[model samples]
Target: MRILVLANFGMGLYNFRKELLKELIKNNHEVFISLPKDEYKPKLEEIGCEFIDTPVSRRGTNPITDFKLFMNYKKIIKEIKPDIVLTYTIKPNVYGGLACRVTKTPCIVNITGLGTAVENGGVLQRITLYLYRISLKKVNCVFFQNEENKKTLIKSKAIVGKNMVLPGSGVNLEHYNLMEYPKPQVVNFLFISRIMKEKGIDQYLEAASYLKQKYSNVNFHIVGFCESEYKNKLTNMQDKGVIEYHGKQSDVKRFYEISHCTVHPSYYPEGMSNVLLESAACGRPIITTNRSGCGEVVDEGVNGYKVKPENSNDLIEKMEKFLNLSYETKVKMGLSGRRKVEIQFNRRTVIDTYLAEIHNITER
Candidate 1:
């Protein structure tokens, strides 16, 4: 079958969904990927997939630009004549999906995350929901990353068609196999996510500040590019010894190797957090928010601890709680997380599920 994939960027596809794409090619299917021309495009091409440069202004909601995107998708679909279509993120799901509908092509959409606009509740949320409702009407299937997202769309009547939930682009266990838990002498915590307000960077920074002053052996590390006005603040914090900032790393396994625990304080509407999944797969204990996307990974004191959303005090308290655990217990906690990911979030499971759905769709 000829398969076409639409997405906003290449980083996520190259990182998370490469396994699925590889499997499709191994099955002798011709695959074409459509997204903005980014660094990972060549990598995707190297993996035997054709790349189509589809300009997408990811964060903006300009009507003229969106209409152009819709038209572009329509043009691509009409020319390629793909047997099936797959789309990720918002613009691809909405606009790509609409194009597929008009062309009478089968399309599958993955709701990676709802973003703050939908979850925060506002005019934008209403507009986004309306777009989803119309675009997904005739699509073959809808895959949500989490149950909360599924419930929200269903309750809002945005998804009245066939849909199901998936473990947000499940982690690759082979790539991120269990690693030895770092020694407890200097307990290091990692905060990996885009430096945005919605991602709870402020809460993480606050916790880092208080904990660093209170404890001498602990180190707080920040990773990922700053999508907000946090460059100067991160620089200041790093210079002052409050946190160690490593801006945007393509390879994070080395950082995970030195870390004892991973911290994610995000309050954002995430489909699922790849950072937590990857960290857990690497046998690292996690300290994250007590929310859906994050809460699902942790087993509440079994694998890791969860703090109240946006509460710096609670975050500090949890870090202290983790700090007080015996070294042996920390190792056991990390192992527990590894076991969870292996059983529940393995990347193979996601790939097989997609293949099964695609097979069923085509056979019908």
Candidate 2:
């Protein structure tokens, strides 16, 4: 089977779904990946996927640009005439699905996250939902990363096709196997995600500020892309010793290994947070919001704690709880987090599920 995989970013494909693509090749399938070219395009090409550059402004929602993106997909899909089309993220799922529909090609869409447009609930949300409904109408299958999102899509009548919930994108257990928890003199807390307001960076910063003043032995570290608007402010905070910001790391495992705990106070409508799962797989306890996919990873006082969304005081309170914990207790919590990922969110499960669906779709 000839498979076409579509996404907004090539790096996302390289980092997250490279294993799946390799498996398809091993099964004697020709794979083509379509996304905006980035540093990772060569990596994807190296893995035997024919890379095609698709026009996608990941942060833009301008109609004219989006229409061009839609037309691009139409042109590419028609030219390639792939046997199966698998898409991820918003634009590819909506516009790419629509283009696939025109070619009468089977589409399998993975809803990674809804993003702020849908979560904010406004004219954009309505427009996005309408596009989703129309695009997904003729899709062969829809895979949602979490039950909350699946329920939302179904309830909103955006996805009326066969749907299944996956464990976010699933963590590669072998790659993220348990590591020795850091025994740093200072209790270090880490936040790993894109530095966006929606990701609850403000809450993390606020908690860090209060905790730093109260406890001199606590260290706050951030590892992720610092968005333009927050760069100067984060730099200021770093200089003042309010926090340690390492902008956009490719390998977060080292950060997780050195950190006492991982904090993800994200209020973003995520499919599931890969950061939390990776941290868990590395035997690091988590502190996150009690909403959507973030809440599901934590077992509340078992592997970690769940705090109120966007509430700095609550985050501070949880950080204090971690500070008060005995070293053995924290280690035990980290081990528990690793056990949870082993039992439920292994990447092989995700790969097998996709292969099974691919077989089913192609056999027909």
Candidate 3:
């Protein structure tokens, strides 16, 4: 079987879904990926995938550009004549699903997360919903990362066809194996995500600034690419010894090595927070928002604490609560997190589900 995948970027596919792609090839399936060409494209080729460089505007809503993207998908689908198409993220799912439906091909869409505009409602939400409603009607299956996200779409009548909720793209347990729980004498808290406003960077920075002034033995570390506006702020903070801002990292495990906890303060709509999952898999406790994508990972005080979205006070309180915990208690929490991932979010389970769904659709 020939399977084609559409996505916004290369790292998202390479870092998160590479194992699935490898398994597909091992099972003797021909795999093709349609995405914007990037450094990871060469690595994807190394895994036996034939790469199709498809330029995508990830954040634009321009009708003309979107029409071109749709046309590109239509062209790719027609030329490749793939047995099935799999799409991830918003643009690909909408446009690729449309192309597949028109071409009379089986398509599966993975709703990684509803975008901020779609979730916030209003004119954009209405437009996105209308598009989703039309595009999803003909797809073979839709995969959602979180139950809340799935429910929202269903309630909004955006997706009425067959769909199933998946554990947020499941973590690669082997790749992020459990590490020995770190000593928290001088606790290091790491924040991993795009340093954008919607991702709760403000909340994190606020919490960090307030906490750094109060806690003498704690450190805050910011990871990922900083947005333009936040650049000077991060630099100033780092200069003042408030936080360590590593521009961007390909290997987060090294940072995780020295860190005691992972804090994702994102209010952004996400199918599931892989940052939380990977942190847990690395045997580190997580502090994240008490909302859908981030909420599902924490078991109250078991693995980590949850804070109210966009509330700096709540975030500060939680971080303080985490700081006061005994070192042994922190280790236990890390162990609980590792157990959660091993039992509930192993990547093999996610891959099996994908393969099963694909086979079911193809056999039909």
Candidate 4:
């Protein structure tokens, strides 16, 4: 079977889906990737996969450009004649699915998250949702990362009732294995995400500031790139000594190993948070917002805590819980998190499910 995976960015697919790609190759399936040209090109080739460069505008919505993208994608699909196409993210899922439909090729769309456009809701949101409803009608299957997204799709009639709900791209347990629970020397809290205001960065900073004033022993560490728009806010927070920003990191496991807990206060409608899953896989407790995708991962008092999104008081309270817990209690919470991932978010399970779905769609 020949499969084409379409996405906006190269690194995300290359890194997160490597295991799945390897499995497909091992099974004698031909897998091709379609993404923007990036540093991962050599790596993708080395993995025995063919790469196709496609230009994509990830941040904006322009009808003329989007039409051109759709036409380009249509041409590519016609030329490749892939048995099936798998797409992720908003632009690919909408425009790519339409292109596949034009070529009469079966396509599966994985809604990774309801991006700012749809979540924010207005004229753009209405238009995008209408496009989704139209495009999805032709898709073989739609995969959602969390229940909230699935519910929203169903409510909006964008997808049918039988669509699959997958837990976010499963965490790589091998790479994020349970580390020996670290003793909290300073009650270090880590937030790993793109430093966007939508990700509740301000809330995190506010919580960090409030905590630091009360408990001098507490420390906040942030890991990820700051978009230009939000750079000033991040800079302001850092200047105020609210948090230590460790710019984009290729290796996040080290930070997870040293930190006592992970905090993701994002109000953005997420799919499933890979950071939270990775933290849990590393045997570290998590404190995240009680919003859609974020809320689905935690078991409250058992493995982690869920605080209200954008509520600095709630976030600070949860952080204080971790700070106040006995070393033994913290260790137990971390163990519980590891157990949760083992039973639910294992990468193998996600890969297997995806493969089975692909086979089912292609066979039909």
Per-residue alpha-carbon lDDT of candidate 1 for residues 1-364, written as tens digits (9 for 90 to 100): 9999999999999999999999999999999999999999989999999999999999998999999999999999999999999999999999999999999999999999988779878899899999988998889999999999899888888787789888889999989989987767899999999899988999999989998998999999988999758999999999999999999999999999999999999999888999999999999999998788888999999889999998999999999999999999999999999999999998898899899999999889
Off by over 4 Å in 2: none
Clash counts for all predictions: 0, 1, 0, 0
* TM-score for each candidate, following the candidate numbering: 0.99, 0.98, 0.99, 0.96
Per-residue accuracy of model 2 over 253-339 as CA lDDT, tens digit each: 889878899999999899999999999999999999998889999999999999999899999999899899999999999999999
lDDT of candidate 2 at residue 215, scale 0 to 100: 89
Candidates 1 and 4 compared by lDDT, better number: 1
Give me the runs in candidate 1 sitting further than 4 Å from their true place. Answer: none
Residue 155 displacement (Å), model 2: 1.3
TM-score of 2: 0.98
Give the alpha-carbon lDDT of every model: 0.93, 0.91, 0.92, 0.87
Clashing pairs in 2: 224-248
lDDT, ranked from best to worst:
1, 3, 2, 4
